[model samples]
Target: MFDSIQWLIGIIKSIRINDIIDILIVATIIYYLLKFIIGTRGWQILIGLFILLSIWLVAKILHLPTIEWIFDNLWSIGIFILIVVFQPEIRRGLAKLGERGLFRYSLISKKKAIDEIIRAATFLAERKIGALIVFERNIDLENYTEGCVKLNAEISLELLISIFIPQTPLHDGAVIIRDQEVVSARCFLPLTINPNIPKNIGTRHRAGIGISEETDAVALIVSEERGEISLAVDGKLFRDLDPLTLRKKLIEVLEIEKPDFIGKLKNKLFGKKKWKK
Candidate 1:
């Protein structure tokens, strides 16, 4: 251990400023890469890989040649394994990186997005038009969005209402708004597999819960049958919320404000009402 420490100290002393800078750059890239994949399915896959590695190590220690050989072969094909297992995640990560600049610029214009969504939802609800709108958060939905009809238009109440008009081609599926733009319309989202979800919930609510379950996105649903507005976040549905309540909930969930007594009181009241129903 003493010799190892001496060698490490010598290596550190021998490193030049350029080498340190290069190391820092590489480390920063790795840090961000891990940050991007954290809490995702990719992280679960990584945990599985680690378990497999531990198993391989045990096999080697036990002199199990066949197991070691199989594990070694799998390790040799690591690149192919990554490609097959993480293609969608990789593409989504790249897309998110590309959009980072746009998102940063759009931060100044987020109020416009909030206003447009509120107006559109209010209009649709008043007209008894059912609409499913998803707002992207940290998790990228690029793969799902790719399967939809792309609409890179500025978000507006009129445009949103027009897209979800009955008999319209894009009226059947959910619309995705990202970076203050309508990224896609008619996007198919997953249906929730939660057995505990109430049987009274329809396909739209199920889809909203499903998408929110899989990603960190917020889903807004305006029900045509009941003309009630619902919000889904993290797979939980908050139904029959008014515009003010919905907006406040969204802002709170999205970390737009610090916690306050009034907000807490409102949430408590809302919780009780929901629980009673």
Candidate 2:
């Protein structure tokens, strides 16, 4: 143990400034990669890979030729195997990096987008209109929105409400929102296959939860039967939220700055209500 400590100290002392920066960059990449994959099936795959690595180590120690050979061949194709297994995660990560770079100079207002969504959801809930709105984060949702009407228009309260109004042509499916734009309407989202979900929840809510489970997107659901608002993210559901709670939740998830007292007061003076807690 003392010898190991000495070796570590020597390595630390020998590290130059550039070496330290390189280490920091690599560490940052690994940290974000782990964070992005956490709470997803990618985490399970990581655990399986770790177990296989341990088994390979044991096989090498025991001179088990067959096991060692199998693991060696596996490692040879590991990069391709990982790409296949983690296709969604890789795509999402790349999308996030590309979006950040492209939108760095853009004047997109996330606050306005959140406000529009909250206003539309509140309007729908008051009238007991069922609506599902999926807010895309990093993941590309094009695969799931193939047949939906392509709008690519700026998001607005009126536009959202009109799309979900009862008897409307696009009322049945979900609205896909990306970067403050209404990407599509009547988009069919994936339904959650979890058996634990209650049977009473309708198809709209199920799809809301489903898309959230499969991607990093957030889903806002307004129920027609109960006239309630709900939020779904990371496969977890927050049900029966009031308007204030919904707004706060969205701001938190979207990493928007909280509204100041005057802004909050103005909203309350208008149609929004203040939640005590």
Candidate 3:
């Protein structure tokens, strides 16, 4: 016990201020990275990896040569695993990082794109046209875009409206928007696997739930029947939001800016009452 106490004291003494700062910085980066990947399939794979790592450590300590050897081989093939398992996330992370340094160039481009999308959504809402718009942030949707017509065009309200017009070729499918560009139209997204979803929720809503469940993408669904706007994130849906509310919520979820308490207070006092109507 005395020896162990002395060893602990020695280790503690060796840890300098720089070490604490380094640890904090690393921890903060990891926290945000995990936050970005939360609710995605990558999270499950990460959990599995942690379990495997724990087992490997136990095996190493226990002198289990066979188990250690297997883990060593697996570590050697980790590059391939990353390529296959986290392809979408890897692409997105790279895209986000690229955008950071060239903010000025991308700002106007993104603003124009967002404006067109807002216009399109408003038009659909006014006409009671159902639409599903999935906006990519730091994640690629190429795999999800399979079987869909690739537009790869600059986003415009008119184009969005045209695609989702009833009985049109792309009317029944989801549209994927990335970097202020419409990458694809009429793409089929996965349906939610959750059994507890309400029976009344239709296919479009289910698809929104599923896609959000699997990725960090935000789903905007405009109901054709009720003309209600719903936002889905992390596999959960917030229904019956108005245009302004939707925009605010989207900005919040996207982490575009820090929340302003005064603005929030004002909104709570005024916006809620107005929305109640």
Candidate 4:
């Protein structure tokens, strides 16, 4: 044990600044890669791979040459298959890295995005146009973007309204907003499995609440039947909201400013009335 400790110390002593930086870069990449894998459809595939690895390790320890050989060959060919399967995720991650390095978001841009979304929501609600709008927060929604309309466009009232129009191709699914831009349109969301949800609550509202249940993202829904606006966060649905209340909820939930943050915190601490079911 003492010799092992000494050996580890010797290795640490030989580390240079560049070596530390290289390690940090690799660690960061791996961190993001794992994060991007979770909440994605490929998560189950990754778990299968891990199980296979465990089996291979056991085979090696047991001196089972045939099992080891099969696993080794499978891995040799399976690496390519993995790349093919995770191609969209890899491409999206690389693109995000490039964007993060190249672009920046100002508070003003976020404000504009909020204004546009509010205007669009109000328009849809008044017209009884069903809409599902999602605001991506700490959790990455890139997993849901695959096969959707990858707009990555500036959030505008006109564009948002157009996308949610009844006859439009992208009107059926949710629009995901990240930072000051719309990351995707027509992205399908998981439906809430909670039985407590009212039977009258349709798929749109269930999908909105479902996403909030899974991640920190906020969902806004426009009810076509009643022309009412609703907010879904943390698996709880807030119903019968006006344009002004919706804007306040967005500012508070997204934590765009200190004042809204304080208000959200206050509400949570005070145990205020929350709309649910």
Comparing candidate 2 with candidate 3, which one achieves the higher TM-score? 2
The CA lDDT of each predicted structure is 0.85, 0.86, 0.82, 0.87
Enumerate clash totals for all models, in the order shown. Answer: 0, 0, 1, 0
Q: Residue by residue across 96-208, what tens digits does model 3's lDDT show?
A: 67756423455345545665776778788888999999987666566798889999777777888999999888898899987667889999999998998888888899999
User: How do all models score by TM-score?
Assistant: 0.68, 0.63, 0.62, 0.68
lDDT of 4 by residue, 117-155 (tens): 999988989999999999988777877888899898888
Clashing pairs in 2: none
Best by lDDT: 4
Better candidate by lDDT, 1 or 3:
1
After best superposition, candidate 1 residue 220: deviation in angstroms? Answer: 0.7
CA displacement after TM-score superposition, residue 180 of candidate 4 (Å): 4.4
Residue-wise C-alpha lDDT for candidate 1, range 134-236, written one tens digit per residue:
9887776776886799998888888999999999999999999876789999999999999999999999999999999999998999999888888998888
**Range of the 10 consecutive residues with the lowest summed lDDT in candidate 4:** 100-109
CA error at residue 135 for candidate 1, angstroms: 3.0
Clashes of 4: 0
Off by over 4 Å in 3: 1-52, 69-112, 137-143, 191-202, 210-216, 233-240, 260-277
